[model samples]
Target: GGPRPLPGQEVSVKVLGALEDGGLGERDPRLIFVPGHGDVVQALELGVPTMQPGEVSFFLAAFPYAYGRPGREPDVPPEAPLLFEVTLLEVRDGPDPQSLPPAVRLRLGSQRRERGNFHFARGDFAAALRSYRLSLRALDGPATAPPGPEEEEELREQRVKCLNNCAAAELKLGRAEEALAACEAALRISPDNGRALLRRGQLLAEQGRDAEAALVLRRALELDPASKVIHTELSRLAKRQSPPS
Candidate 1:
């Protein structure tokens, strides 16, 4: 158990919160940010104020520090004992490193890909792909152009988006191998990426790796159980792998 938090600090936690009923409220082993830049509630504010990074706490909260009025939570009840188990992870700075402007200097190609976002969101798929490739080219180690802030952040952001779009386009174009490679690259950089997981599962199923496909699809489902497409894909895979009559 613990108390209070130092201001302007953020920590990741594995949280379990429950309402009046004995039923499980929210269960996720995934890490969550706490004192997370005012994104949480007042009760959370009260409890997390004294906690340090890597500390763990379990406690029941009272009404004043909990759902004080209506519209906060309809079912949690005024007098309910709100149980919580929390683990503080790392404290964060304003933005992630890449999001922060580079201190050293600047370059030209960086300016080019800074505008790539317009092309990407505009659905000019070919143009966006070209732009990301161009940005990556500028940053390729030595014997080429030097990189800059515009270059580095633009490359990081646009390359990720380009990879995702490539996977989608290839899938639409019936090129499963191309889609699979793009999705794999995206997943390597970001393991919990939703689109990559879905795309990879679809590609796996296309290649007749139905069992692997099912696993990927299931994970996607866990992330978003309300997704009809993922649910349908899982059903199709299950039907295909059923025992012979």
Candidate 2:
């Protein structure tokens, strides 16, 4: 057995999980995740970090740590505890987000963003926002060395996408200030990002900052001249600014 894993480090473990009745609940020969990232259940999140590579351990997880009150459908009953027999297979060095290569960041960032999208689609704005924020963290920091033109461009694009999605999720969660910040961050990455511009403009308008909203919306229209949504927003902004008319 090697050294135990630290937070942020990636771990690969083989898992054999059983329900309260000793019936099998889950079995995965190879499961990889970074601790504290919500990739695994809370019990595993707490258990795996204490294990050295090649070590095997058993953990008893309460309902809150496993599936919670609703439990897993058709198998694990509500409030049933679980017993997990896990083998720590490997531990990879955790990458510092700031020092990660652009390509690696892009890959990891894209995965988190996709996860965010899945949560968003399921109407879980809080979870979606969390995933989007994680994606943003992965994409944070510049390349330690020079990246290819394509890689740099791809990284910026992915960052913008995550920031925009973050804005969307934040808005759904009624965090207007946070949503506006996310829009601004996206615009900083890609100044001509239409989605970011539109969202920023809308948020500004909602806050009664008509002049700022108009400027941002005009730029958005220039980027997507045929966007009827932008056109509509522009019209609404004008009406608000048109005193008494």
Candidate 3:
């Protein structure tokens, strides 16, 4: 047998959750996560580490350890506890964000980003933001091995994408200041990121920082001269800046 699933390692498992009445709660035939990385519920994170590969186990996770007070809504009731059945399928060592090579980190980050996109498309902005932030965490950590140039570029591009998504989700959640910070962070990573530029400009204009918004929007326009969305935003900004009659 290989090493037991440990903190900072990636584990693949099948998991099912049920109410005490034998009613189904939640189930995933293929669930993958890294323990101690907030990838799964606290119970799984704490319990899976003690399991050997190919083992099936059950654990009772109180509300705090499972879905917490709000309890995942609709499926899991508020403050309701769940019984979890978990199968520890495989565990890989040192998929740790801090210790993974750039390539591995990129792949993990991409997976999380895709999950964020899935949630966003479903109008679950909070869930989408959580996944996007996780993707950023996976992408931002220091690499264990030195990265080649192409890998570095790939990593940077992914980071910019996640940050832009974070900004969009933040705005959707009405956290404009957080959204602005996310946009700035993306622009710092890649100054030519048009999505970041457009979002930042919109945030600035909304906050009445007209000159700053104008500058940012102009740069975004330079980057994507044919973007109808950018042009619309620019026109709206112009109307706001015009002296009220």
Candidate 4:
């Protein structure tokens, strides 16, 4: 699910986009952006509007929203252009909470997750774990009522993220077995979850099970090759398996 962008919000966008072979603008935009405020995209109909700053993203965008339609842009040929490669480095929200919907109350968990991550960044492992767990507990309450299509989809996406984060927190706190369980549970919910697979691989390696770790991490790499952390861990695992000099 794509992240939402609110007004007064600034984000860094890395767009590997094209001019569609013909367009009026001389600019073929590329590089990061503190993107100006914008509306919800059709693709973002189920956006996780609670995205935080500094979170990296990679996505594909469908057009005519991606590019102006026929006669709109002289540079674009308008043969049904599609946009590939989009990265949102940061996402911000409006400061005033009253104007926001009640659903945002359910989004507090994400903010707690962010606090947990912040504590992790500061090397306060104990505090980080507390925050992560609290975040999970907060999100556990059953939905008040059945959600609309867009809302249900958004919640599912958020649920996966929460599970993945809890797993990471568990792993960091030396609860390898607990981490494994959390990751597995996440997989049960979303079998192809790359984050769960990646974390489980790390846990397996910590238990001195290199071969199994390699298998799990390899799958994660296939899903997200840009993960430097996973790549580095897999490299170490590979080196450990090499014959002695």
What is the TM-score of each predicted model, taking all chains together? 0.44, 0.75, 0.70, 0.48
The segments of candidate 1 whose C-alpha lies over 4 angstroms from its true place after superposition are 1-128, 135-158
Please write out the lDDT profile of model 3 over residues 99-192, one tens digit for every residue. 8878788888999898788667656688789888888887886777978999888989999999999998998999999999999999999998
Which portions of model 2 show Cα errors greater than 4 Å?
1-5, 16-28, 40-85, 91-93
Ranking by TM-score: 2, 3, 4, 1
* Per-candidate clashes, comma-separated: 7, 0, 0, 8
2 or 3, which is superior by lDDT?
Answer: 2
Predicted model with the maximum TM-score: 2
lDDT against the true structure, each candidate: 0.60, 0.86, 0.85, 0.60
> Any runs in candidate 3 off by more than 4 Å, and if so which?
1-11, 15-31, 35-85, 89-95
Per-residue lDDT over 61-169 for candidate 1, one digit per residue giving the tens place of the 0 to 100 score: 6644444333134455544556777666555543232333333112323443543443445444444555544444443334233457566655555445556766765
**Whole-model lDDT for model 3 versus the true structure?**
0.85
lDDT of 2 at 198: 92
Minimal lDDT window, size 10, model 3: 33-42
